[model samples]
Target chain A: MSIIIRGARLIDPGQQLDQVTDLHIKNGNIEAIGDLTGLNAASEINAKGMILSPSFVDILTYLRDLNQIQKGTIVSETQAAASAGFTQLCASPDTQPCSDAGSVISMVNNKVVSAGFCDLLPVAALTKELKGTQLSNMEALARAGCIGFSNASYDISDNNILLRCYEYAATFGLKVFVQAQDQQLGDGHMHAGATATRMGLDGIPVIAETLAISRHLLLMQHTGVSGHFNQLTSAKGVNLIRQAKAQGMNITADVGVAHLCFTDTAIDGYRSQYHVQPPLREETDRKALLAGIKDGTIDAICSAHQPHESAAKCAPFAATATGMAIYDMLIPLIQGLVDAGDLTWALAIQALSYNSAAIAVGKTPKLSVGEEANLTLIDTSHYWTLNSSSQLSHGTNQALANQNLKARVKLTVKRGLVSYQM
Target chain B: MHNLAELQLTKNGELRHFLTPEGLDRLMLERILDTADSFVVVGNQEVKKVPLLRGRTVVNLFFENSTRTRSTFELAAKRLSADVLTLDIKTSATSKGESLLDTLQNLRAMHSDMFVVRHGDSGAAHFIAEQVTPDVAIINAGDGRHAHPTQAMLDMLTIRRHKGKFEPLSVAIVGDILHSRVARDQIHALKTLGCTDIRLVGPNTLMPQGIDSMGATTHNNMESGIDGADVVIMLRLQTERMASAFLPSAGEYFRLYGLTTERLAQAKPDAIVMHPGPINRGIEIESAVADGPQSMILNQVGYGIALRMAVMSMAMSGQMQQRQAQALVSSSLKGEAQP
Candidate 1:
């Protein structure tokens, strides 16, 4: 419907729409974002003192594909992404029969072809089969419409493989996504320290992330390639990412919504659902990630969705499978940022929207008349958990069950169509 | 009496320090097993104290900890009517150069009779036994991974009671055969009892070199390694054991070496399963097999106490005289034996 959201607090980080003004939308495009109290359209969305900004974007998501345990193909995640207000996402190539080729990229892209819910992009594995031994066919994958190159497990045990990956992906002019974690240190489950101690559980120390990030940043500089560090956990890691950004390195980074929301302390008594790879870190590290998000060191927030069945998380902490929280973790997680006052409404919207759109389409979304209908219309006050029911992907692995969440999407519009309308 | 000073332990009323089962005699293991059998019922009793060591201090000066072993020792000592004191070396002054002898001297000053010793050095119990100047008793809880004498004795007791004899036994040890102190101790004890055929089986990464010196044939293949073995002793795989040597993945480890039903069938039809505890379910052995009808790992935990009682009583036998004398003097100071 042609509509004008009247007297709303429009926040356009690209245009610096921090001031309170009414936003006008017609034909599913942002027509004008001026003070229009008596603006005329088919419908007037009373967005007074509410955020009228572009929809959120999560650069990383572990979407489950059926035949290919690699990309985002699960029916559940697609619906949940729309509900959680993620319009665009990049799925890692780390699956069972990994996405290392153009065929695999085509496989994911084709499956998500009908997925008008969110803009799902396939992230092909940087190395062949995620063995960290050889580089995947970058040219072939790019032809298959793969947007990025990344090691799904991002396990760069051999420094030569890493250097070559950067060098090869650099040759393609395509950025690589790296879930960089040092293989040697930080081998434990939770974030190391008093939390792990109290839970009698082992933890991967924060130094592992910082060390891994530093190594990747150095590798990027060495190869002069663009790579994004997936899920920057520690403050030190944030500082390191910030340093790389300041050094004019073409390195972008993201954090999972869970990492932004929870701390390693959530692992008290071995709560399995809080268990994610490159795990939820310490409070200081969580704060650092928040600060990174706030200061733009962390470029985007992704829901590192991993839907494990019941038997997966039932074993002992060390023995259990590492991955949980797909459908119901994002909104509350972001809401937690707003609640704790670490995230501003404007900055969060920028990280969620234009920055992600910039990365996906390789440019920022402007307030001009003819912009593509890739927009998100969210009300500040809708609340519900779709995945918490039997339809939930939890299968009883919901870690943030009682956590308070606020702020939700009323409708997510992609290409001038209601991709996910609640 | 020649080695009376060395007798810091007593089992089945014998006087001797339980340093090595080799010179301690093959019959000593049987005697310990018998004494432990007598105390097994005591463990089940609500009033477990038998007054065998009442008013006596039993110090557990463990230099290395196996929570499974330490707990059993504590339970055994408490059941024997002794006041048990556990000293963990990791938290003590030994890390600061408090010599083992000096620590022993301090405990001796406190009138401790039995030293349930567990030291990281294999011969540490033997070292302490050699230096026991007077009537104190030494029960080797475990010393390094070299030997857990009581563990060996108890394991023997469990074997003899279950299988009736070691002479006709064919035992197999799987995983960590190289560095396991329990494997060494069990091997020696089994050898003393004339266990004719013993197989050492595990990946080359885990099997100790020169295991042929222990008179056990090393088998790289788990299928062939456990062939016709009467008892299977599965050791825990310590990831710490991995050096620069690249071991296979946990999945690979399980596939190649884990004691699944298929692998377990390689042993004798009636052979039982034994693990020293804290088993890695999928890595070294499967869950169904570990908790299966034939697994005695939990029983081994229970039998540890009886074996420890046998060793402690035997080691402390020589001290009975001095202890009785002190008791008489104290009673006399209380104006005659009141009863």
Candidate 2:
């Protein structure tokens, strides 16, 4: 199948290309870019007053489809990601059986291939069953199409075991994803601050993130391993990652999108939807995270999309599940940031699409000729409200439901095929 | 987000549920105190029962272990002439792996008029009130470290009976303020009752992060906290605090921050000492000071029944009124629909 997108402002930060132009795609590849006025294909899109850019990539997400279909499935979550303009997703290994074996990776790959909507890069568990005890078969997992290795939120308390895991990954030239959190100091449900005090809930201090990041940085340096930090929550954590990169440590970091939009105070009245892990921190931490993104200390922005069934969030605040089903409203939230002048269009596109794609796939996506057609068209002036009817994910536990959003994803193209359309 | 304080009241500004005292105004708090004052006389009578909740069914649902709180709530419900059913959820279907929502749904199906919930999770009562059973009245006996509204109101009763009013009083709450639902509710009640000089006395580790922002002063030393105070409230020191490293030892806590006779003397000459008891004698308070002439610990317990009865009756009446109003509106709409 072939298509021609006409008169859309194409933006590709990786190629520094931003102009209103026509593009031609033939057989799942961009055939021509500049003023393809005579090009004809089987399909045509009149993309006037729209933004055509490389489709977004989410570096961290959870698709618990294998055993927890009640929460979400591979097909359901990928469909939602496509609606939100993401064509690639790196699924975390915090699944029911824990993606620590080759079979689990194969199962996910088979499901993604059958779905045919987006690419799923599985991050295999570093430890067996993610119990932080024995190491998994890293070589076998890589052969099964694992993009990286991580223990997810579970910590390896034994320093010796952690050092060995890093050393083993370094030996194979593998990238290890670290979610820095000292479990002992991270028992609280929300960030340690005045809001937690007023609510009378336990607080997880900033030391939990800083201390764990500090240890992991030192260990990664010692083992000469390529490390990537996931969901940095505190200002001090950003400083640590910044210093490590300044010293030429082979490290990269990203922050969850929810953390950039909210602080601990959003948990007022004990709203269970705001109950996330690596809890929403204070305002200073939120501002610092934005600064880190602007200065390039933070590499990408992830959806951190965890889908839960309604029953999971139907309990008390502390007893309720610890995530929001964010994929259904991810782009609108980012659009909100851009409209408020808190983020620029270039940086937003870079963080959401180019940077995330490079980190997850080890190569940046482009909108130039001869490249595979992976694109998203966004109507920047479109005003829409997100509610249960508008939400596409199976998980209806959205925290931003019924909220007004400035932009909408009008269409998504993956491999030169229309994957999603408004 | 549903505010517990607002959820506890009807649109007519009457008590519908007694969940928390945080958003309650001075007039509403004074009304609760006044209502409890009338119930105090019923406890002294030969009958010791009232017909305020005669046809209502009150269910005491304790998801956590409790003896004193459960007994007081049960007695309060009984004295109000309401049929009471006590569910020891720790050994019931909850322990059999049933979810809290499932258990609540089963209980709700029983058509119980009110739920007296004491859970180990914060905001459990609020969840039930907002999500599960909006029509049923909910009394938060205790929920995690969030709130114990009835306990705070009873303490307020004790203070008013001894000191005559709340405006001229200085109150000091000492011990484990961070983990005490009673302390949090007490701070809100005290501030709303117009007590400006409220002091939270405990070690920095034991004090919550922003107690001062709740309109109370923080004091690590007991003497300074209770200095010239009219009422001194001591919270129970759970032995688990030592195991969790929140304190060095019980003996050390007693030496530094415990309410000894000397520390008690720092308050006013006629100051009353109170404890939400099952108190450790030497850990949080000395035996002499606890049983001293100025001690009102037992009176607080006696007043607890009256305070709970007042809250239960008020909430039941408010729920009835709200239902009646909703019925009226529906009937009027039906009338308009007819030809």
- Candidate 1 residue-wise lDDT at A130: 83
Q: Which ten residues in a row have the lowest lDDT in candidate 1 chain A?
A: A194-203
Model 2, A1-422: lDDT tens digits are 88888998999998888899998888888889878787787888888888899999988999879999999888999989899899988999998888998888888879987998888888999999999989999978887778899999997878999999999999998889989999899998999877787777889999999999999999999999999999999899999999999999989999999999888989988888999998999889999999999999999999899998987887778777898898877777887888788887678789989998888889998998899999898888788888878888888689988988778898898998889999
Question: Per-prediction DockQ, in order?
Answer: 0.02, 0.53
Tens digits of lDDT, candidate 1, A370-404:
77555555566655544445233433466756544
TM-score of each: 0.58, 0.97
Best by lDDT: 2
C-alpha positional error of residue B74 in candidate 1 after TM-score superposition, expressed in Å: 16
Expressed as tens digits, the lDDT of each residue in B235-311 for candidate 1 is 88876554445465767778888999888888888999988878999988899999998898888877888777766
